[model samples]
Target: MCVEKTPWELVIDFHGHTCPDIALGYRVAQLAQREMGIRPAPDSECLVKAYTQSCALDAVQVLNKATIGRRALIIEETQHHIYQFHFTGTQEIHQFTVSSDVLDHLKALQHPDLSPRERQNKVLEGVQYVLTLEESAFCQYDKIPGELRKL
Candidate 1:
C-alpha cells in the first residue's frame, strides 16, 4: 500500500535535510497559507518577498508554490526572518516576522564552543522546537495597507 506524504515530508525531501531554518520556513509557509488562503485562488498570482536567505525559503517554495524559478520569490538580505506575501487578487499584503525569542534560541545554537556533532544535535532539537512552537509564539503577522504590488 502507498501512503501520501505530508507537506512537511515533501519539504524535508526537497531540502535534503531538516534543520531549524527548514522548520522556520515550514511554519511560515503554513501560516501564510492560513492567512492568505490556499494557492490557486481564482485568477490569483502570488509573490513572496523574503528578507533573508536560508533553507526556510525552500519551505515557501514547496508549500506556497512560490519558487525562484518562477520569479515568484525574491530575497532581500535584511538579515531578518521576515517574509511578505502578495497576491494579485487582493491589494493587501501579508507579512510574518519570526519572533525574537525564537531568533535568540537559534543564535544560541550557533555558539562557537559546541562541537560539530553537538551543534547538529542541537539543531535537530531546534527543528522540533520550531515545529511545535505555539502558533502565536512562532511569529508575528500583519496585513499591510493595500498598494499596487510591484514587480
Candidate 2:
C-alpha cells in the first residue's frame, strides 16, 4: 500500500516590523496544525520568539546605518522570506509576515502570459511556498528573480 503525502506550503514574511512576530508565529503554528497535522509542543513559542527577535534586530540595524550613511538600502529578498526583523536604540522589537500569497500575487501581476484566473492561481501557489519557508525557520536572502521571470 502506498501512502499519499500532502503537498506542503512555504512561508515568507515580507516588509515586517517586530511586534507582529508573536501573532504571526502563533498563526503559523495554527496553520501548520491544520495543513500539515504537525502539533508543535507548547514550548515551541519560546523558539519562535527567539528567532523573531533576532531577525528583527538585524534588519533594523542595517536599515538604520543605511539611513545615516546615505547608502543604498540593503535589500535582502530571497525566494524563502519576505518579512524581516530589526531593533533600534531603546526600542522593543516587532514581528510580522507578508504571507506567501502576497508575493505570488505580485508575481502573477508581473506575468503577462497567463489568463487572469491562471495568474491568480499561480499567486496562491507562490504564497503557499513561502509559508513552508517560514515554518522551517531557514531564510535565504538575496534570491534574485528567476531569469524567466525577468521582464
Q: Best candidate per lDDT, number? A: 1
Locate the minimum summed-lDDT window of 10 residues in model 1: 142-151
Backbone clash numbers for all candidates listed: 0, 32
Q: Which tens-of-lDDT digit does each residue in 45-69 have in candidate 1?
A: 7889999999999999999888898
Reference-based lDDT, each prediction = 0.89, 0.33
Question: Would you list the clashing residue pairs of candidate 1?
Answer: none
Total clashes for model 2: 32
Q: Where in model 2 is the C-alpha error above 4 Å?
A: 1-84, 90-111, 134-151
